[model samples]
Target: MPRLGLNPDHLALAGAELADESGFEAVTISRVARRVGVQPASLYSHVDGSADLRDRVAMLVLGEMADAATSAIAGRSGRDALGAFADSYRDYAHRHPGRYEASHRRTSPSPRTVDEGRRHSTLSAALLRGYAVPEPEHVHAIRLLGSTIHGFVTLEFTGGFAHSAPAAEVSWDRIVDALDHLLRTWPTSSTDV
Candidate 1:
């Protein structure tokens, strides 16, 4: 019989917490088992293996990030939407580093990837919508936003800019502001994304 109160979701949540404290690379079945006060073998009943657990963690993180992005950007549009969306993501990365890392590592989501993922993508795409980007340019805009946000977050996590001026928060705000301006003035192009 399965453990009534213990399952993939619980394990993933606990694992995410562990990731935040230690780092995403530190998350593993053994470490999570230790945190949950269960035998390593016991976790096998809930998760196929470390990979499966990681996938669950990624899904959970994505859901959370999607929610945060959606909530923060409500009643907003264009540059307003862009900054709000960026703030939501930056806040999530700061608060849940582990979950944020998990979110980036692609996991073949449990069927909802297409649906749930669309909503998440729309957060940025909607922001881009205000910019009047041409057909193909819109795609580039999306990739640009992803790269900028991820690159900044990754660097901040690794202490890349911890010793710099303007602080990480300030840099994030400025980056979003710049992206807003760039998108608004984006040139029409047919460069395939």
Candidate 2:
């Protein structure tokens, strides 16, 4: 019999907190059950297992990040919008490194849809629309933006940019400007000369 007031959402939410406190790798059913003051077996009723719980946590984090990014970039457009989006993403990644990692995890959407990724893509597409970017160029532009943001952030998180200069802020601004310029004049098929 399931415990009264215990549920999947409660367990998943608690697991998310555990992830924040101990890192995603440390999150486990046993640990979560202990944190929740429930027997480890009790958790099985709410979650199928570790993978299901982890996926739920990932989805929650992704949704939160999407919401934050969406709110941050609202009422903005063009480079301003892009800057807001990029800055917001970096901020979220820095603040919630574990959740940020989960947000970008490549997984086939089954019970957990990556709607947050879709929302983010919408924002990126909107930015591309402002640039008049066409077909493959637009897709490439979006990937470029995503890669630039993720690459910088991931490297910084892992101390890969330890000895660099110009500061993250300066580099970030320059990157945004570079992206803006790239989007504004996305190289078409005939531009390879």
Candidate 3:
């Protein structure tokens, strides 16, 4: 017998909320059951277990990130698009720190997750089109961009900049500008030189 008004999606949503309230590691079937006023066994019908629940949270986070990235880069190009794309990631991390952390977890691939992952890649490639990065170098460029954004956001999110002199915002703008210039002038292969 399933509980009324409770399903996989609802449970997943509750898990995500719990992840945000505490860390992702804090999300457990027992805790979520308490959250929804049910016993731990009651959630078994909705989620396979803790792993399945975490996978659902990962999928939800990825989907939300893809949607935000898509919206952030729409009708924009060049540095404007680049900044917005980068900011979208930072904003999402700040807004949903736990869900953002869950996004880094490896999960079993399902159709929805695969599609969301592809959409993120497609959006990145599309954003890169505004710069002069050759197709061959796009993978490298994407890695650089993703690393830079992730590194900066992680540090900022974890109070790494608390003791800094200049504001993190100032550094962020400079970093984005530097990325823009670097992408615009992406170097050619050594053989071409």
Candidate 4:
């Protein structure tokens, strides 16, 4: 029988906290069960396995990230919105390194996760709307923005910037400014001269 006062949500939450505290790779059914004061088998009642637990954590992190970005970008537009979105992403990654890493993991699609992903994509599309990026190039712009933010945050987290000359903050700002300019001046055609 399942433990009293234990449920999927509780297990998932515990798993997420474990991931945040000790990196996503450290999250496992045994660790989560231990955290929740239950036997490893007790966790099976709440989660399919470690993968399901991790997926739940990933969904949670993605939703949290979307919420942060939405709040940060509200009532803002253009470069202001861009900067706010990027800053929110970086801040979240720094504050929740393990959960942030979990957010990057690919998971099987479910209604909730699909909607969560849409919310993120919609937020990014809204940011691009301010720059008037064409429909045909939306995917390209989204990929570019995602790559830039992910690259920067991953590097910053891994001490890649520890040996750098100038401060990373200065470089982040410059990158945002450059991205904004690129979006604003994106070519309408690919025809060569």
Q: Best-fitting candidate, measured by TM-score? A: 4
lDDT string for model 1 (67-166, tens) is 9988888888887888888878888998988779888887775676666677777777777767777756666788899899889988998999988798
Task: List pairs with backbone clashes in candidate 2.
Answer: none
Candidate 2 lDDT over residue span 14-39, tens digit each: 87788777888766899989998989
Please write out the lDDT profile of model 4 over residues 1-193, one tens digit for every residue: 8889998777777877888899899889999988988789988888899999888889888989999999999999999999999999999998888989999999878998899999888999999999999977887898999999999999998899989778899999999999999999977767533
lDDT of each: 0.83, 0.81, 0.91, 0.91
lDDT of 3 by residue, 136-192 (tens): 788888899889998998899889998978999999999999999999998878664
Look at candidate 3 and tell me the lDDT of residue 10.
93
Off by over 4 Å in 4: 190-193
Q: What total of clashing residue pairs does each candidate reach?
A: 0, 0, 0, 0
Error of 2 at 38 (Å): 0.9
1 or 2, greater by lDDT: 1
**TM-scores of all candidate predictions against the true structure:** 0.90, 0.89, 0.93, 0.94
Model 4 weakest lDDT span, ten residues long? 184-193
Candidate 1 has an lDDT of 0.83
Tell how far residue 97 is off in model 4, in angstroms: 0.5
Instruction: Judging by lDDT against the true structure, name the best candidate.
Output: 3
- Which wins on lDDT, candidate 2 or candidate 4? 4
